[model samples]
Target: MTETVAAIVAAHRAGTVSPAETVARSFARIRAHDDPAIFISLRDEKEAVAEAEALGARKDARHLPLLGVPVGVKDNIDALGLATTAACPAFSYMPSHDATAVARLRAAGAIVVGKTNLDQFATGLVGVRSPYGIPKNPLRGDLIPGGSSTGSGIAVSAGLVPLALGTDTAGSGRVPAMLNNIVGLKPSLGLISTAGLVPACRTLDCVSVFSLTVDDAMTALTAIAGPDGADPYSRNRPLSEMTPFPANLRLGVPRSGQLIFFGDKASEKAYGDTLKRWTALGATLVEFDLEPFYETARLLYEGPWVAERYLVIRNLLASSPEAIHPVTREIIIAGARLSAADTFAALYRLQALRKIAERAFAHIDAVVLPTAPTVYSTAQVLANPLELNSRLGTYTNFVNLLDLCGLALPAAMRPDGAPFGITLLAPAGHDAQLASIGRVFHADTKLPMGARGLPQAPLAPLSANVAAEEIAIAVVGAHLSGMALNGELKGFGGRLLEATSTAPDYRLYALETTPPKPGMLRVQAGSGSSIELEIWALPAAAFGKFVAAIPPPLSIGTIRLADGRGVKGFLVEAADINGARDISAFSGWRAFVAEAAAG
Candidate 1:
């Protein structure tokens, strides 16, 4: 069985394994695996071992987070000594410096073992698009490994490395992880710097993480996530501490008619089993209309976003058309015909769709969907490239477009022995929240680590560091996770503590504000409901600033929790509820807004 990041770090700290020994073990596995397509280029064994040896000599080496952990870098991300081919020989170039994300990983003591393969210029969802032979799927060799993060997914799944860096544009990061039965974390756009990455769609591209477990993925994210001064899109978003999943989470699922399994009964069954597990774990499944989300997904390839892809290869497309993959080239060239009018029209449509999305999210904390509708064999995709590739993006293409963060977890194994996975998505800056839920869900399944057939390491106690320095505030309405104006909390460096409910002494009212706001007021215990609310921790210094920004009728006050604790939360004055609609029966602001949207 392959060791996990936590296990490796523990072993290193205890002096059970030296960094040089671990690096050697990784190379041994890489060679023994005999998978040429998994890595396009690898660091020299002696060079990597020497680097590890030097790290081991440092006085503070044992204190490094990822000390001695081996990692694979997607070829598209610049690694100091490797040539980034992005699986295109003609476009390969040696980089003098590491990508911002890679630099952070290295600084945390992670050793870059190699550069993995990918779809040429990251233009396809099916792994077969690469001219480099397809990386054999670790679970099922006949099945396509999913791409364009093909090799990175395979390496981690096969235990060649516990962590790997992949780039997500469309479904490159997530689809591969699902197909390979590993964890994929597509973070909020700009959360991880893309400064040294080759742009697939500059505005939409994100450096993604792949690991054997959600904890490992989160560890890598913590080490690498932050803003880079050189990257214009980099953002200084706040990351919350990992806490337990809420007791009664409202999760949205696509309506029955909206699910598209594409005739794969095994996948359909796997998803059904997953839904049952979620319900069993105390999540309230809410079915919602997915038409708007699907419509938005179509815009990714059908609209001006294709122009962004064209921008990356315009010069190459014109100078050496034959150098690019035929299918990938066909897709990029279409952008040349798009008019500026076409771009703005698509942008306008997206703005309208975003409003619909916001309304949809107001009803649930996160949306759960199959990572990919179905899996295709290499031969199957080769016969029908365009349709199969599009199908793979059914649940993924809208993520970056809508600026949401996602975490993919292995859910079940199909009757046919194929791996099946689901992704949890939320609005931007909810990366930590997704990980919190994802960790619990992944552990509940008790699935083995990737394809290694080893039990997952026991979950460690969540660090309560964020709670120590910040104050937890309960929010029930527009400030709830994924709702409108949630950005204000994020702007104050707030972190979601957990989703919980207020005491049974509170009544909720929908106040008549411009965008509408919910107000909770203390009432007689027998007359009020325990309303759903999220606890967010804000820095002590910023809490004052956050309270000062509140408008009339809403003010911070001590609110009692169901557990008998009290925290400062949003409240409305008694005078404001006179004409406001009493929505206490809905129990939470999400349900109240959902009912309004449906009507």
Candidate 2:
């Protein structure tokens, strides 16, 4: 009914579709489509219609975004009166509150359609882990529809809804998106609150969005993302300082040799073709080692983290294990054997891998890789459950574990007609950067929305997350670009925004030092001249680390900017300047150093 949320709102304003009519259309479509597997529990249409009517009765309701746009929910998320089955009967419980992400969507004027199917307790990517019949892949019914987010994907693909909420742990959000050829936005973990959703892997879970287009995904994310105090891992890293999608961008490709295809020739060829398309988009391609990433992924399953899953549902498994799907039961039961020491060992190795991962950002803005090595037929997935599920996550499992945010979008189709896709990933809290770049890639490819043949519409450029939760800190000399301590700022997640001059009340002094450094001192009012400096947005969580990296002579203090914005910038302690030489006349350290060499 609402192929376009914005369009629907416009139409409603133009008197083309009333809120009641929109609700009716959704009800008609659900019955007309008649796919029971698509919804595990249905919301009463009469009640939904009544709510829509009330929305229509409101004055100035036309101003509401996503007005009358009906959406579906994955069963694991809470919605009043809906049984939170999590695709396992034993895990079912009716919740009294909407999940944080769901509450945000509803507040945006989207109506709830129903709760869709998922892999039991959201533990697989193959969709078949559910005791409920696997939702048929709309693109290829015989193939697996993908999991955890399974029914959310199918609902969008089948045109039953324009958007849906799904939980992504490992590849729940992404795998289904790839298989169904829709957009799956796995936000930085905890960017959108997970408060009312059942936990899968608590620390790694993210409430994800599935939509027909990049713009819709962005709109949905902007509405949903914010700090939720209830979620321990929730964070607010305002995208305020991030550069918008660059006109000329650099994309990192996981080195080809490291890619896993699992013997699917068609998928391998399709991926190679996508890489060629990347070149055509004028993106610089750089290859990087992905072993450390894969090493981190293997630990998620090959280690004791499964214990976290068991810890969440130990009682259910103990009391009613038979109620879980056979495959899901098998998977969860494996967790009981791990000792606490195993969890500790995995944590240590993960930290070492984390250091290795930091190296990737130096080479490129985001990393692109196949979303899934290959997708399998429903029968194939069922026959070899664990193996097939693992293959589908070849590129995904490492993402959440490594604290990265990812977006999966459809790419080329395999020769046999199965969908193949790729995910663009960045470190945690970089969701906006990844989404901006993703919009470029999504629009560039010209793929259809869901399984419908409506050519993908252009995204109104992503509003940069410029309100990013980082403090704008300025560096005048030693900690400036290419300086000895530059990495310290970058390691703590500082991103340089611009190089410019400070206000007219600043002076630069060259300090005498073992490892040469310079200090910038703010002058008395109207006295010192403006000096050249660079501004970097330092993540608040990592500001302490950045500060610790600074030596004694330099300290952080307020400095007025040319724009009248007061920000954290470098300053020199009065006692450290006795032997220092003033270089304010040369403009900046680079200019001063260059002139000194000429002498």
RMSD values, in order shown: 13.0, 12.3
Candidate 2 lDDT score at position 188: 87
- Models 1 onward score TM values of 0.79, 0.77
Q: How well does model 1 score by local distance difference test?
A: 0.90
> How do the residues 1-599 of candidate 2 rate in per-residue lDDT, one tens digit apiece?
44766567667777788977887887798888887888999888999998888888788677677787788999999987788998877677889888888888878788898999988888899887777776778887799989879889989888888889999989889999999988999988878898998888888888999987766776788777889887888887554323445767778887757888988888888888888887887788889999899898898888887877888889988888778777777887888999888888899999888888988877788898999997789888778899888888889999988889999988876668788899999888777777767777778888777776667654542221323477778888767888777877787888877666767887788887767767888778668888877888887778877788778788889887764556777798767788789888987887876676699
- Given candidate 1, what's the lDDT at residue 576? 85
User: Residue 189 error for model 1, in Å?
Assistant: 0.5
**Model 2: how far is 243 from its true place, Å?**
6.7
lDDT of 1 by residue, 260-340 (tens): 999988999899999999998899999888998899999999999999999988988889899899999989998999999
List runs of model 2 lying over 4 Å from the truth: 239-244, 461-599
User: What residue pairs clash in candidate 1, if any at all?
Assistant: none
Q: Judged by lDDT, which candidate is best? A: 1
